[model samples]
Target chain A: MIPDKAKELQERNLKYAQIIQDAMSGKREDMEKRIKELNLASTPKEVIHSETSIKLYRFIPVKKKLHKTPLLIVPSLILRYYIMDLLKGHSLIEHLVESGIDTYLIDWGIPGDEHGHLTFDYYIDKFLKRAVRKVSRSTGVEKINILGQCLGGTIGVVYTSLYQEEINKLVCLTTPVEFEDAGLLSVWTDRKTFNIDKVVETFGNTIPADFIHACFQFLDVKATVERYKKLYNNVLDENFLYYYKALDQWINDKIPFPGEVFRKFIRDLYQENLLVKGKFTINEKVADLKNITCPLLNIVAKFDHVFPEKSAKALNSFVSGPVDYHIISAGHVTLVVLFPQREETFKLISDFLKK
Target chain B: MFMDPAQFGKNFMDPTEFNKQFYGQMEQVFIEKMNEMIKNPAFLSSISKGVETGLDGKKKSDDLIKKYLEKMNMPTREDTSKILQYLQKIETKILDLEDKIEDLSDDLKNLKKEYGKSRKTEKKK
Candidate 1:
């Protein structure tokens, strides 16, 4: 024997619940439709430029240019080089090419068991040296302007210091020469909890993925998660989705760092801090940054988490070359691809190359 | 009320058979709608387009992630601990080596100076 008023209230409540449920179902359907629609509309291309064991990529430019000094980009072997030339509108390679700069990138290909015997000395003496010579000869220039990013930059610095006569203008982006200033990487190498020799010997050319992943996880874990979430939310348009997929593919593509090279990097650069201290020796020749005489353009990201400002900035003091250092406003990846940064960094690089 | 057997047969049905018939109709309706979507050129094109776009976004994201990881300088826990162990051992060895090298250098310098002084005395005599 419920009251008449209570019965009326219950009926109304049930009706309201039904309406709300129906609306929610409609929204769910809409979201599913959107997801399917997006999945169907995507057009992504794999742009890998590989030569021998080395692989890299170039961004296609909207506009073509006339004659320009071929710019050879060297990215760290640990990661793919596509970050520099990210997408159509916000690509360093596209921007440079449109601005009349001929660009070529060296991709350090995925290291396999065969590359286990390769060392930093091997990279410097064999691959980088041969690549530079080949590019120079192909371009009909005695010396080609070289730009190296991160570890690649360190290699470039060493190469330029040792063989300045072969290289014209050298550009180093986030390259760490002084290991003491390298922060966590330096500390870890100095401690030696991970036996580089044992790992290298076991895997040959391949360093473990778990080991590399752990290094990055230590730095701002939350920020990394938030970035992807924001990326998914912000990219509502078709073109942005294409760009996103392209970036995603390159991000997950991990390659093993060669064992001998890993050992040398940890022992020589990180532990001894030899390159900047003028105590580094490669191929029986004392490698000194003071020997670099070419025009140098050192680009350092102000908020770089990995290489840090101190490590990159230390290059100015070490190199004897006419150096122009630009402290750009961005992180490491953003230096190459982000809109405002692309304009700023490219403008500076172009201006220096012209000079 | 007087009911005809034919009328009752038309109005009422067996529960199991009725359920089966109802479910069969619903399944047919769903299949028809799905086939319509599959056959629609515009819908298929849209799906293909979306897939292509997603793949592109994935590739770019991968590149950025790889680059970021490559540039990051943070040390792993294992690396940090190992470095600490190595530092302790190296420090001891370096200190011992430094002392030995310093002593040897001082002895050589003193010997050179004394030999110079003796040669001068001999000349004077």
Candidate 2:
């Protein structure tokens, strides 16, 4: 090796040795304490409606000139609602509220034993519908806008299809519509390979959060390993450390997907691909995507492993309204977590809602 | 600009760089192989079978416990779950009542506004 290269290597080695020495000096203990005290989901909000395990929150607006039509954000049932309002400054909810969009969120709280019997129909009809009605009634507007992410987006699409007249605009963030080519999840939930009924029967009420976490972790073990590597490399970066710890906490904070809802979601959407086929039903009402005539904004992640871009973009072909389709260069989680992509996505959503 | 193969190899022979490249390739290969294995039909079937067998054993043991608890006149998970379900049903009924009452109240307010508007219109005439 060249002399300069050798010297650079020597310095890097010394740096590593110092980092190890710091680790031995209980800097890690301080990090652990700081992580424990890390405040997340810090945006101020009030519970506007509560039923069973679900709570609908209306964020206290920071701006005076609010939009006429209120915006309701629906997150995946399996994940916490805080992913949207993750940090005070770096939050989608905060951005929307600051932009003067009256915002509401459906927090699908940790399900209990009794919540296992809760079906998809109940979630769509009762939980989502009630949340929408509350937002609409409270805002005194007949029409409202909805922004849903992942599985929540699927629920929003169905809800908008059933109640298109009451929806002014619909935004879907990386929502899988054509599950036939959705990705590994579709393959894993195949009827021939997997026994959904038996699994539901065994678990009884709600699928444990750990089981879901394990499955997701199993999806990309290399990615999980690389995440730790990144965290290690950025140990000295306070900003990076804060964001990483916050995201790490959110990812680990898992919640059970109610049993019957899981069964139906896998069977109908993942296995059968019913929603795009216009055969999926909620409470005896067919949720045909063509019924969604409101202006639709579908944002899909180009590099999403969970829901492939093609699968998410399939919403555009079905919706009757004019579609504003965008495929951003980001992964499923990174679209919301990362800076540049997150900012772009927020701008797209806020601009769409402003229209 | 000419260089011998041995000298070129030596030039690139840093242990740190070698380790990074080797591990990067290994990670790629591992991920590719694992994804392929996971997508295999036989692999999926095997996993399903393992899960089903494990769950079956658990179910059998849980049944045994339930029987013993019943003999001791103690409530099992089923008993508690049934009661919870009943309470959820009652809660649903109450919510339904609340919804109906809200709708009626809105209608009453609308009727009162219409009546007040008609009386004012008659006075204007």
Candidate 3:
């Protein structure tokens, strides 16, 4: 007990000395410059197709061991796509490319008023179909793999249900499928209180990014404060500074949720819990999850605030495919944010894809 | 047990980073007691209303900014969107051409198959 106290005191003194030395060093200007100069999406990519609100990029392969089936990454409409392609050693795109996986990413660019009118039909039916066709035609392969993140997984699951023949496999990471959990976001977006039609009518084109970001920040005020706190405390450490700046860049880069998609997502999925019910229809056809016959790899996090375990486990219900579930110690973005978590997640994905 | 070294440090320093055990215990001792005193339902109701009001304020400020930029004749997202509208029109035309090309390819394949069938029939005759 005495030795433990001495060790604790010594550790405390060391931390204080580190903090004081960092403070005394001219790190203020250095930190400011680092924050301002930080850039993201470092992996080399060629825009294979570009449309109004979407830019489909094919990441240049780093090795010659190319696979026949290509992989397309579709992220949620909530933010920019650069979070997946952050930097050299930390990028999922880089890892996939180096591992000889032909990778493509869909950049849902700034949603305009026109995009506001686009529903899952337009995304799943029109945009995704075209993107898939473009990739398949370019590669001379009919079926390709898709790994969708968050709401993008919902889009993938729905698309696979409808157009199973077109896709080789489906991957969902931290995908929120059911609204059974009484999480704060779910409770807040409850139809009884949060009227979707009214929000659409009021906001017109899109739910402003500022509003969405504000709500996200409101979820864990403590976490946000702690992030900056850690950054400030480790201001002198170049490695920590780089990591924080990369993540901070992604956290700030967000686009407004398109109004039409937001309305349907909130009403049908969030409010009515429609996706898992085999009742939801995109493009005037039934999107029964049972119709997904391809291989499925569902990666759910244990403590996903946005998509809690109980909510994300709804994938086990009516999936007629070979379902592989992987639960990890992570939050929503930790799969890409933390280095070890990102490495493990990507390795799992690569192995699963190859298998 | 969901922890990293940094997270362990944070939770040790900040109660906000409370572990499951600590959270349950602290809730009873602190957060829950505070909630009981303030009535969390009423507190959350006010916070929710405040958030809605905050979002509304943001929307209004956005509209104001749009108008201000328009008045100044400065290029804005609206202008870029207008240009993209024209680009979309062209993209649609390109897609139409692609459809036509696909149809032509199908026609060529059919013609080749018919030619082969006719040659076989002639050989049989």
Candidate 4:
């Protein structure tokens, strides 16, 4: 190697040595105590309806109720709902609630073998519709606005198309609309090579949460390594430690996806790229975007690795009504954790819904 | 441009700035390489192919296990799953019947209320 390169390599080794020394100097007990103090999803809410395994909750009023249309936040079914309200002051739901936005969330309880046959159609037609009706009756509103993130947003897109009259507005966050050239995860789930039927048959009923996490971890091995290294480097900082614990806890706390939903999601959405092509269907009904007349707001994370910004922005072209497309300067996880991005996302949801 | 020895020494002496620059460069290079690897068609295609092959192997192994279990007169996972599915179907049917019964009961009560009101009116006449 060149002389300058050799010198830099030596300096880098020295820096690593110093970093290791500083990292070791932090008190072990202090780190343990801080981690133990990290609690998540402390927001109070009442379960208004429970249909078998699914539950719909109404967050207790924090700010004075001003809005007629209650905003329902759909939980990505594969993951637990509390990531939206991970911690006090850092919560997306809390910020909206305190701002006087009528907010609700669906807790898709962990799927068991009994729920294995519950397809996307069953979820959207039977459960989602019932929840919307429950909210509408209680709030005395004809139509409600829905905010769905990630896979939940994909569900929302389908539901809004199917039941256009029920929804007043649609807000999708980091939702993959056009799957072509999307990201590493998309590439890995290519239909021709991936046997969805075999995987679903083998797993049976519900795919374990650990399986999904492992797959996501494989998407970026380097990022995973860098994240842990950064974690150790900042273990001494109490604030960083708290948020890290909260986020990490939320990521690990996941729900097994209903098997039928998983199969359809992989085959139809990811494999065929049907939603963007306007050929996606549920229960023999065409899920045409033109059928969706509700005002749409597509919130995309610019640096999202799972659903890149280009894939998410495709929503703008499909929607018939006015589409408010907002791009934030954050990655997928940071879109929820970082204060500025989270705050901005919360603000955008409330504002777009009210419009 | 080659840095003189004195300048390099000055940069190294300020450990904080040097560390920041070093890590920044490292992160930039790491991300670029990762992105390149991810976007490579051969890499992605190979991953899918490998996963498919592994899946096929799993399915074959599962089939063999089920065959052995059947020969020993043991209940297999498929057998148990089918039983569970049947039970779930029965449970769902029962729930539906219950809802229908509740609706019929409400209708009967309403009919009785109207009869009572009509009888009272006739008695007054």
Candidate 5:
């Protein structure tokens, strides 16, 4: 017990000494600078196509021999697209590129006030369709694979349901299909509790980023504070500090959901639970999940607080095609961003795509 | 560092690790409580009303500002968005025209080739 106590005291003393040494040697400032200057999403990519609020990117191929069917990554519009290509060693895009899958991504750029009127139909019919066509033309493939994360997965599922001929395979990571079971978000956006029309009328074009950020904060204030506390505890550890700052940067980077699209998403999907019911429409045509005849890989995070696993897994029952459903033991963000889990997630995606 | 025997025995576990565990448990419990509160109909009603009131206030202020700005003959966000929408329409038309032009060009090339082949056939005859 004495030895243990001495060891603990020694460790604490050493940490203090290290901090003092770092400060005296001006190392802390350098470390802070390095953290601030860390090159996130460093994987090199070229923009293949660009329109109003969307830029489709094709990552520069790392391998000589590439897969026949190109994989298009569609990330949620809530945050930046770089979550797939977060850091040098931690990037899903890097892992896929290294594994010889031809990778492309849609960067839903920051929406301007004019883009407020852009509806779910406009995105699916105009932007996403154009992106798919561009990918097909560029890669010279009749059909391509799609990997959509979160809300992007919903878009992919809807798109595939509408135009099944264009997709070879569909991948959904932590994607919500049955919004009725979408936990707190569903509860918050319930027609009885929330005034969607009033909010839309007040905030003309799009919900402000700050409003979205506040919603996230309200979801779990303790967890949000815990993140900062963890950072403070590990401030002396350079490796931890680097990743912490990198992720924190992304956490704070919120984007406004386009107004009309937000309205449809909440009303049609969350309130009415129309997606799984086969009533969700795009461009005057109903999007029936049964129309998705292509192979699908639905990845669900077991502890996803944002969208529950069962909510994500609902896609499996609706589709007529073969489904490869995987429930990884990770939270929503950790499923793609954090270590071990991300590596496993990447392997699953790459292996599935190769097949 | 010198440590008393009794105090030393009690300090076997690191304080930081202990704090982390305590914090984790506290956070989890707090989050659970928050989630419960979020689901409460009364809580939801209050939050909904509060947000709507705030939004109404914002809208009224924005309208007042817009009116003042219009009186000054200055372009507002609405004006800019209108212009942008017009430009977007024009751009879409241009793109459609470009696609048509490319198709027409391809068709013209095919027609020219067909005409040349006919002339050659006539020469042979």
Candidate 6:
């Protein structure tokens, strides 16, 4: 009788397993089809004025009037800049433009073997600083409003700290100032376990896609799985599929972080927690947060799993600027994209910059 | 257990009485759980913290619910529980692997030291 009961349980379990497997396979097929459709549908627009090194994609403001200072958007190195300007309705870039803000976004080109030796100082001092100078010179404005998202936010903060005179206003979205408080990513990147030298040596300027994917997976393993399942179920709708594809493309669009820059980032920020401790040194000169004296606006996602509120809030203590910090009731991406008009986040940012 | 309509009518002519009896049992269960929560300081603290953090959004609420369910000694949802268990196992495995790597590193260091000593002796000879 006991053997019969055990066999019955085994059969039931096997049936359940089969059901899950079928569901997963169906979901995968739907997702792949949707992805292919999206790739076909997407129209890649070329920049009106393209430079040799960086391509400038311009999205003119919907309203004829422009804000006093032209806003420059800097997205993270891990993902594409289009995530900020995803779709017309859900796009932060569109909303900003419609609200009469002059915006220009920098698309950090994918790094090559030549960029392997590029250090953090090069990014902050050379690329970003040079970009700011060029923009300022072109616009004939002494100072330009600068905004950075994710890792770009970190770079923005570093830039602002070092060269506050060049920046009129600074805004950071979901930026991590205190690396020690940055949760799993911080712990994982710490010196003891991370052999960055081997990775840089092997891959040159580019870190493997698997490594980046693994870091994101570690953030929320269940959500990562469930998100695709949900996407699969909703793949029939063209609009939903477009949004999913845009998001998927942006998510999978991993850029090779210049090895030397990455090395400095991990060593200075994660290993030493130098930014918050006020010990970060740039070009043998200390990059002190106290040096930043611009009007600062720091927007943090209340429910950000990747960059926690604590990590973002650490900037409050470090910066000597006229700072205003607001916690938006959205996740990292939604904090910028969703409810672009209704949410007080956009209005607050606009008002700050306008002043 | 079939009751005659006349007998049933006679037993409880009022619907209020039946409802009172039904809800009285539910009230007792609710109070018992509440009492259990209050008695345990850790459970109480966790519940309060959960409520505090629950204000963030859906993700925070879900996390709070999961934590609350664990604290209440209730069965967790299958997917959530499975993922949590898998993560715990992975974390443990990673720690173990790191320990082994550290040990191997130490062994290598000692081996290198011994080789250096042997080479010095060979040079002296």
lDDT of 4: 0.78
lDDT of 4 by residue, A218-255 (tens): 56667776876686567556677667667765565556
Q: DockQ of candidate 1?
A: 0.01
Cα lDDT, model 1, residue A159: 88
**Between which residue pairs do clashes occur in model 2?**
none
Q: Cα deviation in Å at residue B21, candidate 6?
A: 35
Interface RMSD of each: 21.9, 3.4, 6.4, 5.8, 3.4, 21.9
A1-355 per-residue lDDT for model 1 (tens digits): 2366456546655654543343234233453353343342121222333333564333343346534566778888767666675555666666667766766777786665556555689788866776676567556787888889889999888888888888889988888887785755554444334344544544444575445655563453444554554453444445654555555444544557877888888888877788877888889888888898888999998878778889989989877878898898998767876678768888888778777
What is candidate 3's lDDT per residue for B1-125, written digit by digit as tens? Answer: 55455646645654333444465454456534543533256665776677667668866886898899999998766676567656776776798688689879979999999999999999999
- Residue range A1-355, candidate 6, lDDT tens digits: 5567457556655654543453344233454464454452122333533322344455655676677798877778776676776655666666677777777777776665445555788667756765676567556688888898988998898888888888889998889888885866775565555555555554445565545555675465445655654664454456665566566655655556767777777888887889888889788777888888888899999888788899999898878878999998887777866664225767777778777
Question: Each candidate's lDDT (Cα)?
Answer: 0.66, 0.84, 0.76, 0.78, 0.84, 0.68
The parts of candidate 2 lying over 4 Å away from their true place are A1-36, B1-29, B123-125
lDDT of 5 at A204: 87
Query: Per-residue lDDT for A71 in model 1?
Result: 73
Higher DockQ: candidate 4 or 6? 4
Model 2: CAPRI class: acceptable
> Compared with the true structure, what per-residue lDDT tens digits does model 3 show for residues A1-355?
5567557556655765664454334333543453346756778889998877688999898788898799989889887777787766788888888889999988888787766556767788778888888888788888999999988888888888898998999988888778755366787777655767767766766787876766676455456555645764566577776676677656766578888888888888888888888788987899998999899998887767677877777886778989988888877888766767777788888999888
DockQ of 6: 0.01
Q: A347 in model 2: Cα distance from truth in Å?
A: 0.4
Q: Write the per-residue lDDT of candidate 1 for residues B1-125, one digit (tens) a residue.
A: 53343533543354433544565566567556654654455665565455446546755674676566557965543344456546544654674465578669869999999999999999999
- Candidate 4: deviation at residue A185, Å? 2.5
Q: 2 or 6: which has the higher DockQ?
A: 2
Worst 10 residues of 3 chain B by lDDT: B31-40
RMSD of each: 22.9, 5.4, 8.0, 6.8, 6.2, 20.9
Once model 1 is optimally superposed onto the true structure by TM-score, how far is the C-alpha of residue B70 displaced, in angstroms? 38
Best by TM-score: 2
lDDT of 1 at A185: 56
TM-score ranking, best first: 2, 5, 4, 3, 6, 1
